[model samples]
Target: MTNSTRIFLFFSFGYFVSYLYRGVNIGFSGFLIEEIGLSAADLGLLTSLYFLGFALTQIPAGAALDTWGPRKVNGVLVLVAAVGSVIFALSDTMWGLMLGRFVIGVGVAVCLGAAFQAMALTFPTHRLPMINGAVVALGGLGGAVVGTPLSLVLDVITWRTASFWLAALTVMVSLCLLFGAHDTAPLHNRKRPTMGDQLRGTWEIARTRAFWQILLFPSIVAGTFYAVQSLWVKPYLLDVNGLPGATVDGLVSLLGFAAVFGSAASGLVARRVERWGISLYHFCGLLLALFVVTEVLILLDVPLPRAFFWISYGFLGGTNALIYAVLVETFPRHTLGRVGTSFNMLVFFLIFLFQNAVGWVVELWEPISVGVYPAQAHIAAWVILLALQTTAGIWYFASKQPKKLEHL
Candidate 1:
């Protein structure tokens, strides 16, 4: 295989594993609650730890990607994830599970940023939108599996057994990434930035107006989307939509399946819209708006086919990932690692907050029955999330357009 193809496959596979780790809690929540006796608040705290660990790694991982390249950084880190999976599988207590999840987050945190940086190094700038989308779509398939496929697996094996199998898969992927992935020729000759220089570069990326302007809407949308998809979507369906367990699994799986297409379409559409003179920023805003409208419908509990809204959510929710392409266009190629991870840090940190916030909001109301929060609690949580997202959207549109974008 071509070196570029090898890089893409290995990094893409790593991202696939990362996404699976992110969404596994959704499918396993029942097992966790039943076995560990977790409440909504406890489950939220446990699940959000993954995002917290992921968020913490971004800046430093960005530097490492810029220095050692993705192959070395990602390969080594993924082993940590494998170890985390083992811990999670063996643990019975909440603290043990949280520790395992946190370690898993730290391990896989490099996957998305490293993939984006590695692709930027290997592929032409113009092709990145589509390539990056394809990567995310593949990762979304992992999300898809964690829904219904994981449910089917749980029918035959314990969650602990499933986790152990997942860990083993993670270790195999790590070896592939370490031994099989190749860096582009330019990356081999690039100068290593000092730790001080990398930190300064990361801070500069964070402070840039273009970064924040491009980030606000998309980050909020991505954060909220993950928060809902990873944990709360099942509860919402159960309590608000009154769907049966089997039906909820199917719909959740459908949402994941739709995301695979949606993220892929976002890239293709972003490229196409640019031909029509629509800026990537505007296209992103449009997707974010569509996502918000879908969330509103869900929050309102509209009478329309429930699958329609969930599908819309899955499709539009992650299209904001295209924002990485936008960042590439604006930033220098050398700093792409920092730029991608800075964006990711905020996005996942917000996911952590949004996930925990939903649980905290729901915790305000008494459960309608054991483990079933009231419909109003779920609705209230959605309202708060939507309000924050809408506020971010308004701020983004009202702000001056980035100078880099004027030419694009």
Candidate 2:
């Protein structure tokens, strides 16, 4: 009925699709590995492709939204994601699954960037931060819904069929965007540069030391956060902590529940940092991660303390919220959508690589001179992540300046 409602719906649709691509993997990973004979490594590598595809399209996606407008681009991308879901459902091999996931990867970058660009184009400037948080919170809801209990539904039916149903939902969402989820004004920025300029966006950012400042922090923050959440947490609970059945479910629920608050909290913090600020928001995140890893290591050395389960939850939740909210504020909005999408791509790619390598690195360490503690190994895994965040902090502090919301 109104412009605001239309903007909200349209943007929500984009995240809804982006998250569907994310959520389905957790639900189906176990089933697929068991049925299709994919190893844990295979599942990690293949699912990571979704992020890679998502990352790869950032610049183009932002430009598409800027030039083509969200209505057309969002519809096409959702349809493409639906196709990925369908392919994943039908696949019996790892390579086939990778192809399917890659489709999702490519489509989701468009979905995420287009949604944000739509918000920037349509919503009032003051509302963008909160609205952006709302989109992520919605996606987290989708993720929480797709966990073990939902996976049980896949048991009764086949996960393959479930995948098909998810795709079908995307198709429904695509229709929703096509008809109801649209704005009155089109984003035809006549003064904007040619398509070639848009395509060179990522490269342009790469050229600037300042871009690296904006770039590396998000890569570490998002990479480690998502990597752990997606690939390792379940195993961390099952293997490291020795949590079983109901306990595992409850813990997973805790992580997701914390995320709900974390997303909103991030936006609020960003708003609060309107004046002079002195903190390594992203680097502090890894420091928090260090605290988490060290605590987990202590728990491993001795008897389990029930307190840790909640304390660790709070620590991670706080970091997650801060990192996300800090993202929008860290860069210029002109290239916000492009940088955001590209950042997601790099985060995904690095998360997959580092996460996969950690295990082997640990194994290699254990047999050699230093006896390996797995928790310590993860702490070490985070060392490089923290260093990158440090580098990012130095750059953000020294080079670029953020504009006030009044100007945005």
Best by TM-score: 1
Tens-digit lDDT string for candidate 2 (176-280): 777776565555463565668876766775665544554565466556666666555665555445567466555555666556555655555555555446443
lDDT score, residue 241, model 2? 55
The superposed Cα distance between candidate 1 and the true structure at residue 129, in angstroms, equals 0.7
Once fitted onto the true fold, the runs of candidate 1 whose alpha carbons sit more than 4 angstroms away are: 188-195, 405-408
Residue lDDT tens for model 1, 243-337? 99999999999999899998899998788999999888788888889999999887776889999989999998868778888888777777787
The residue ranges of model 2 lying beyond 4 angstroms of the native Cα positions read 184-195, 272-334, 358-408
Q: Of the candidates shown, which would achieve the greatest lDDT relative to the real structure? A: 1
Q: What global local distance difference test value does model 1 have?
A: 0.88
Pairs in steric clash, model 2? 53-105, 54-105, 55-345
